[model samples]
Target: MKKILTLSLLFIGLHTYAQKAKLELNLQKDSTYLLSVAADMDIDQLLNGAHQLVKTTVTGTTAHKVTAIKDTLYEMEVTYKKLGMHIQMGDKEMGFSSEAGADDLMSKVIKIMINKPFIITMSKRGQIVEVKNIDSLFSGMAKEFPQVGELQLTQIMAQMKQSFGEKSIKGNLQETFVIFPKAPVSVTGMWTTLTTMDAAAISVKTLTKYTLDAITDKYYQVSGAAVITPDKVPAFKQSNGYFMRLTQATGNYTAKLKIDKTTGWVTESHITKNISATMQAKKTATGPVELSYPMKIAMKFTGSDK
Candidate 1:
């Protein structure tokens, strides 16, 4: 009897260790989800022999409505319900919100963006394949700022595109959604994904390794670690006529996420990132000066089917 019980216990232990979960987006057609994200960033820089600190906070809410599912691709209409940003440098503060009136350029732009819907095509594995209708949205914004000169408008459009363009949107979405493993993942199962991000004039590549930590009746807990590497930098001329380029950059990123097992949507997530970088600044009258700084960012994200 003792030997038989030992064998039975061993079989149960093996079965428990072999349990797996398939993580995929399984939302029904016509379903809608609301997701909110908030991020705070702090930057400390040494410039001109002085230490300067800057703080910024950003918050946004988006609604995603599944419109169709064809084969393995899902089409969804995404709309920004709210967006806001606040920045602080020393004692001064500035901010804009979608709830505010169009009193300034930033507020006007926020007003134009609110409630505008764009379509995104995503795979079942949560990869964002394509984004559509963003150009049209920008065209509408241009019409609102008719008094601005064409050259200035072109520059404004270029800057806006860097944030709202299809590629940028795809990259942002993939950070949250493209985290599922292709196959069923057991506890302690690990997978890696590579992503590229555009920051100002620099391109950063990140390779993240994710591990399934635990599974419960309601959610799956996962953790990730990423190594960030900055690509070759191209010098960019600033509005003040000074040129700047990234000389070196290194960063670490980590995230903890709890995802709904039924819908494959993140119920809650926390992410922390730290980056140390050196920038070379040059001008016609001065030699290049290197400024080293460290930036820290903390972000929280949550999603709900309601």
Candidate 2:
């Protein structure tokens, strides 16, 4: 009877240990990983009482090659392998893909982005330290489109910079890879992280609570819930001579992730976010108009080590 009791205690101890994990990036030099990310967004706008809905989908795949490791930081060379976008509004539809022929201006620009390599420096805890060569790369791409008018080219470059700039890249990387706790955590353990999404026209701050849901032999399942609040709302001048400014914004975010136990990398993730905002349009002929904008975004990400 004593022997059976001892064996039972040992089993419990083993199970407890298995439920705890120290999640940190354990990337090796010379190793490579492929990451695919996709996002679908739907925006419903009531502008001056007229309603419109727009849908957009963006997809990209990139390869991250660990070139060097210094202390707790990893230096990686990242190259875009594929990129595509599709947008639909009412009866109009537009799309572009790097794999497709460069038949249109947007497609030509996307083709130029493929295979361009940049460097990222990140800590084991998934803090992005530096993003290098992205600005220069974009500048080079601008030079390739000489046929475009200076004004149109400037607008295009501005939009690209706003989306793929250093700060934006850091924000995106942190959102995905910075889910680990500072110390080891067991199943049901919770931690919080504050992150920001800063863009040219708007900024949002998110406070997320992450819980370790389950631990398996090969991976850990984690879930997160966040409250998103507007940090900054900048007035944007529309092409039609009106200025649009967001007056009120609130949102909620949720995510589920599967992280590799060995490498601490996210193998799969799904995120859903909903935002409701009020905007005011000024300088219109009929005077100031209030607009209601509600947006929903869904994202999926997958990564595999090669």
Candidate 3:
């Protein structure tokens, strides 16, 4: 369990950071950044080959869990241009390309898990590339999968503007986002695109009417918890604004951000997410994941030369 322990510690730190992850860079203000990243991802591929491996480790497995957990290594490269982030397929990709047979595999699944690994690098304009991060990516799954919609970055940003108004992004603005399954807590990865690719919807409400926090000469923090309406609570509440947080509640989480004072750019980022959930057992299963912290992300941005 040494690996698990190491991963747990690393993830713990990262998750906490992600809970309040930084939006910093080492480059100059208003510059585009590109980061190279690799990771040790713990994934449960839909049909990880070793049926026997499936037989050994997991207990109380589900058809979907079995279907989802495919033992494998994931690989990928990233390039950030403009304000957009793009991922170029990794080595270990999970989920069936199409949805037709996805449910069929969901039947035999009991329990599924995977550990993903990757490498990360950073660079500035005409600067030498520096390696940034490399570690394990962990994930787990049980049963139920509710269909949720996929939010588009455009829609998300648009919503941000609609709710919060336009500001000159004076400081660093960094973020990571994820979605869960609709039925309860069955979402491992994105299962559906509620809106068309052209019309993808982002969680504007999550980023709405938000106030920015003061920045230290070293770093500053902005929180979504304060700006959101109570109805937006993802788990506990289910209305339109359920996910929105209360106002001025930055005390709830911490985001360790590192900034380059000379140029007001972020150098590196470490995010760790921790969550506590309360659930009541249902007749056939468990209660909804009354979640605290959700899919936390840690990202490092660097300016690009070539």
Candidate 4:
């Protein structure tokens, strides 16, 4: 009887040890890292209650490099390496690719954007602090698409500036920042945050909750769930005698992040998001019509240190 009791206690202790663990982030200055991100997006348009009509799918891959310029600041560079898109409407289908001999207009545009570089500054906590070279990049694009008039160019620049401006950057920073507790977190530990973004095309407010799920010698696994709602929707830009107005928008996201225990860097992460929106549109022939669009976006990121 004594031997059996001792064995039972040992078993309970081993199980408890295996079930829970603590995790904390460890970061250092002057570190350079590279992250490869791949994204897949699907959008479907519904009109008159029809479930399927027009749909688009896009897949892209990009590399982001970050070098610590200061103890709490980093310079980030992003380069798109591959992009592919497919569009479907009834029996008609179209495709675009950033590959040789793809004559589609979107293909050409994708090619132009693929190799071009975008640089931004970010905080150590993953907030985008500043987006550099807005005017120069758009000027270069204006040269490529000369048919775009000054008014349209101005509107486009306005949109871009609104998205990358200081206020917007702070909002983005909040959304992207991973909030860790001041003390080490055990498997049962959890944290939550709320953020509002003033997006040019559509504003968003999100509430997210994160939990520490597991920990190993190499990395810590964190899981997050968020509810996203549209706070504001800008008047849609008109093009080719067609205009659109957003009516409603709502979404949710689930994310998984694997952080290196030693470096406190996110070594791998994946996020899945679903959004649904209704819009009113007016075309030259089709008067005013209401349409619903549902979109899904999935992204995966993997990182390595230099």
Candidate 5:
């Protein structure tokens, strides 16, 4: 009888341990990638619990021979929470915080959304939780940023233009265009729109798709567009409502992104893995491009305690 009692107690203890909830997360969004760039940054917030979330500003300034000379900044109020394997965020509430790397007008007024890593974890009663390592999370999200070599925005632009020029479009204003060349025509800029309608229009189509044409040996016949029509969009709990429409390539593709719905800003988004052929040779001749394995962009999201 004593042995039976002991067994019963052990089982009860095991059950209790299993019942303790840690943190559950379903990344509502990583970020919305409206356009490709030398780098991506954004600011966002989501409300998971009654009083939880973190708000802050971010800035990233890099100069290369190819793209813009001006620096970039992101400022935002961010919120996050966990609920039974589901992590969420919104514009109203936030529970995590990160200090500014640099304090300035451009940095304070902007919120960075892409390449920011954050951890999410829940407490016993599931009332409190956390999101950390946002900068790293985003920075480390993709494993295949550059199969050949990482390039500065300026260099990326320079290569793009050298490969294909006049075919691409230019504007001090907002617009979209395509370039047909071997490599995608290179485009470089820090694009910010002036109005909601303009943002909506820009969000729907890719601005430019060709760069280093002779080197890449590919062309961007970009088509379609998706926009989030404004309509009192709710918080993260059920804020998935938005207008999206885009052209297809007669095949299947996976889409992922991080979004700040409060301001209709798309931080970063991408079709599953952007596959590209590669050449086994590291150093290559300055002329014809060698061939190699297609690049695979591996992305993962991690969660931790607040």
Candidate 6:
């Protein structure tokens, strides 16, 4: 009788531990939320002595409110709340605070970005549909820098968009949404998502495999591993009026996510990216020079809804 009772309790425990839950977006329309991301980059290059080290940290915060909803789609208005950065290279270090004025280039860019409104549309499944209100962003920048020529403005706009506009926004949101499965998932369940991204004029494809690591009363722990490979080699213009081609490239990433159970929102995420690439720079005078770059980047995100 004692043995039977022990076996029965063990069976009940196993059964309870195997329960599954459906992860779905529970964000309500006309609600407000706070989103923030902090990124750190460490760059090493073979330059003078040993290796040159460059460290940079960037943190940004934005407030978002759902303005409209149509069917399963949601339109959100976002306002920038904070933008701050810190950089250190050898003996030189720099910092930028939100109170800086438009006198300097970096300050001017930040000035243009503050309080500006952007619209993002996404589906109930957490897929980003589109990003809008970019033209207004540029228009405000133009007002600040009236002397910049049209061609120069265009180049600046391209770089800005790549760093902070549609692509960056979508990529960040993708990191959160890719882990969600359409159906209910049990512990140890696995899923996959494929993403294509541009890196230094090369199109790279990443295949990420995710696993449901654990499920608690409050949070779901998920883990992801990715393999990145170059799709094709592309030629790009160099800063010194020369041409360069990407020769070889490969990378990998690992991420851990802690998601809120009731809302399906990611409360915390930590991701690390490792990349190795070789580039051939054609010099007008000296034939060509091959350079190898190995880089690492780390990113973190935290958010809350109110």
TM-score, per-candidate, Cα-based: 0.84, 0.86, 0.23, 0.69, 0.18, 0.80
Error of 2 at 281 (Å): 5.5
Of the two candidates 1 and 6, the one with more favorable lDDT, higher being better, is 1
What TM-score does candidate 6 get on C-alpha atoms?
A: 0.80
After superposition, the stretches of candidate 4 with alpha carbons farther than 4 Å from their true spots are 1-32, 38-44, 135-139, 142-183, 239-241, 282-306
Preferred candidate (TM-score higher): 1 or 6: 1
Tens digits of per-residue lDDT for model 1, 38-89: 8888877777777788888878889999999999899999998888888999
Model 5's C-alpha root-mean-square deviation from the true structure amounts to 25.0
Model 4 scores a TM of 0.69
Q: Compared to the true structure, candidate 1 yields what TM-score?
A: 0.84
The C-alpha stretches of model 6 lying farther than 4 A from their native spots are 47-50, 99-103, 146-156, 199-202, 232-247, 279-306
The most accurate candidate by TM-score is 2
Q: Which 10 successive residues of model 2 have the least lDDT summed?
A: 297-306
Give residue 134's lDDT in candidate 2 (0 to 100).
90
For each candidate, C-alpha RMSD in Å? Answer: 3.6, 3.5, 21.6, 5.4, 25.0, 3.9
Task: Indicate whether candidate 1 or candidate 4 has the larger lDDT.
Answer: 1
Can you write out model 5's per-residue Cα lDDT over 1-306, one digit (the tens) per residue? Answer: 999999999998666444321111112233311232221112121223233322222112211111111122111113211111112335552222223453332222122322332333321111112323433322321242344244443343333232112211121011211111222122221121111111211112222321111111121112222222222221111011222211111112233333222322223434321211111222223333232222221222221111
Candidate 5: stretches off by over 4 Å: 1-253, 256-262, 266-271, 274-276, 280-284, 287-306
C-alpha-based local distance difference test score of model 6 = 0.70
Candidates' C-alpha lDDT: 0.78, 0.78, 0.25, 0.62, 0.24, 0.70
Better model by lDDT: candidate 4 vs candidate 5: 4
Better of 2 and 3 by lDDT: 2
Off by over 4 Å in 1: 1-14, 146-155, 232-247, 280-306
Better of 5 and 6 by TM-score: 6
Residue-level lDDT of model 3, residues 138-226, one tens digit each, is: 12222122232234323433333332221111001123211111221111111221110001111212221122343445544332221
Off by over 4 Å in 3: 1-31, 35-254, 276-306
Candidate 4: residue pairs that collide: none
